[model samples]
Target: MPTSTSTSTSTSTSTALLRLRRQLLSTAYGNMDFRYQLLASLADRALAELDRHSSPEAEELADSHLRPEYIGITEGRALSEAGSLGIDTSGWEERRERIRSYTRGADAVTPDGTPADSAQRLWASLFDNYPSVAAALADLLTGLPPSWRMDLFQTNDLTQVPAEPRQQGDNGPETAPYSSTDWEDCAACMEANDLCRFHSGFLAGEQHLRGLLATLATDSIALEQLQDRNHEIGQRQARESAEKSPERETSQ
Candidate 1:
């Protein structure tokens, strides 16, 4: 009897979870911002699970690479990986140096000198000059859940999906290209341009999605404020009614 009850409970829980996932996916279907929320949540939970798998020694090794002394270690590692893959690492050292020159102290100064709130300069440079790297980084980090495998903006034909407007930078190389082909090509063009809507334009598209999410958040805040205002008005009316009730009762 207990085994049967346990099986029934498990089946019920699975059914409920499936229903909830379908509901969320349906809401996220045409809504880009909600899709981002669902994706981000899934990514965060996955990362947390992965983090739990890390041994202390593995974390220590990873942390060691993050130290100031290991400044060029990441580039060296990338070069090693490229060499293993038989990819040409020709000008990578020079490119890395140029990137370093631009990134040095970039985080120290904001135009407004607001150190407390600063932009990630190193990330900005990479995403600006080398969008492919940004795409790889995003894939490594999040690599969307299976549920989000469907094309984000598509009609009856997936190929007919419209690319967002391209916003250029001063440097042509820095400008993310609009990929007409696929998400991989599109992501390669996202070099810090927030106007691109392609999944390939990872960081920029995320930023664009985030802006929309922020607007939604503000709307939610406005709704909460309105509810609070209504609550206050209700309370005041109740108090006034209570205060007048005794006088009316005495008069009667």
Candidate 2:
């Protein structure tokens, strides 16, 4: 495990790591919760638009955000661990070197003299430092504190989108930075028609992935057909460009 000289700071690091340790069993759940929180933030904007009559789509938007599911576990145990790098009573950028030495991966290395595997292992260790990750693992065959605090991510981008309700209009959905689902239908349709999926989903069946598929299949613009049309459009553009060229530009 990583070390913190500041015994006072140890609690904070331990608390943070316990959070990530929990996630070992709840990666899916964490991602799902993260998505909804994002949606709720967007809804707040729509809700504020009372004076402008509301959009039918916006209500659907609000409804979608309210729906909730749980984040599942990340699975497996971490062979190593990390704690918060205790900063001196004073904080400064150059002190990062001191902190690096304490991370779970600080001394990890391969016989070939590379830290690649150990480095990745370190990432899994760091994520465990979050309450969300810890909560996900609470039910696993792992140990967790009885009085654990939930760790949540806060982002200005979440509710901080610029199109405050008053600012929204046909500037299109682009005005709002958008939570994942805010423009889900539009984005899904775009994805479907684009065929980025069919490549086969690795983590495809989970809620968010399922949700994306549901949207693309049910409401997304016709992707397969669109693909064909896009090909045609490209051909047309090429033909047009060719016809307008000043020289035969060679049949090369």
lDDT of each: 0.52, 0.37
For candidate 1, what is the lDDT?
A: 0.52
- Tens-place lDDT digits, model 1, residues 1-252: 644543453345434333333443555554444335567457434433433454233334434544578745576687888999999989877876654565444525433433222235435656766778878887865876544435444344444655334333311232334566554324323332222344435656777988877876779876687679999999999999999999999999
> Please, what is the TM-score per model?
0.25, 0.20
Per-candidate alpha-carbon RMSD to the true structure? 24.4, 27.0
CA displacement after TM-score superposition, residue 130 of candidate 1 (Å): 22
